[model samples]
Target chain A: MIVARIIDSIWATRKAEELNGFKFVLGEELTSEGNGKRRIVAVDIVGAGIGDRVIITTGSSGRKMLGDENIPVDAVVVGIVDDDCNFK
Target chain B: MIVARIIDSIWATRKAEELNGFKFVLGEELTSEGNGKRRIVAVDIVGAGIGDRVIITTGSSGRKMLGDENIPVDAVVVGIVDDDCNFK
Candidate 1:
């Protein structure tokens, strides 16, 4: 799991059928210092918006969050953080 | 997937039961310029050794490579790179 901030939303007309109904967002990892350089595209399962700090899960655990094993996604936003003093 | 070089092997006397028969190696990610700071502990399934550049798959795909979805592993070395024009 990683703590990140949603930076932007992604839209693609032509993608794998399994990804059609999902909303994709770009997230930048959050570290104790600030935002880290690692960025990833993740499915927004928790209705997170831009600038929202979120908890992202990767790999099979991510796909399992969507209740399907066949989705072609490796990262998913599982939760939105209400408050955090660790990162700015 | 990511390209990395095996830096060292890891030995753990106490670990999860599902990881008993697997060999874990420390890998440093490789970039076009040189080695990146990102490092990971991965189960080596392709018999890779130190100094070998290898391809690693993460998540469920990695667990699937070992033919066991129940393994508590997120990364796995799937192949060793024979030759490459890029990266130092």
Candidate 2:
């Protein structure tokens, strides 16, 4: 898990049906800038914040997170942070 | 900090303006199915799999993961797993 914040959101029409009832929010990853690698921005909608550590989902499970097997979502807020998540 | 699998997807219509354009994939939380907490399901992208250890973004950063801070996102896949993440 990483510490991050919700900055904004994105909007797109002409999309797939699997992503019909989901909301997408924008967020910034707060990891130490790696070897010249650029920071990342994500899209979510689980009511996170600007200084909270949140858990995210990706890939196939990201697909199973929903249940329809076709929505086109890649990342989702499976759980929220309520305590410390020291990965060290 | 958890392992999961993508099961399916969901679609919605007439949602918040913040969530305009984003893909939603389905995934299931894979944590030993503890205390029968109704195994959780999530929506994500980042091209994960049914048996992958992934890193996700949530909360405010979940929002900032994106650029626009008004699109309405909460969780996102900022990075993928390439090694072991022993959080203990």
Top DockQ hit = 1
Residue B30 of candidate 2: its Cα lDDT?
A: 44
- Which residue runs does candidate 2 get wrong by more than 4 Å? A1-3, A33-45, A49-52, A83-88, B1-88
* Per-prediction TM-score to the true structure, in the order listed: 0.51, 0.40
Error of 2 at A35 (Å): 9.9
Backbone clash pairs for candidate 1 read none
Candidate 2 lDDT over residue span A2-79, tens digit each? 234455656779667667767676545433332222233434555565555444444443444355556666666544
Best by TM-score: 1
Per-candidate local distance difference test:
0.72, 0.47
Tens-place lDDT digits, model 1, residues A13-82: 4333455587777677787776344666678988898899999988777777677665546678999988
**Number of clashing residue pairs, candidate 1:** 0
Predicted candidate 2 versus true structure: per-residue lDDT over B11-72, tens digit per residue: 33333334446544333444564322112223355666545555555554655556755434
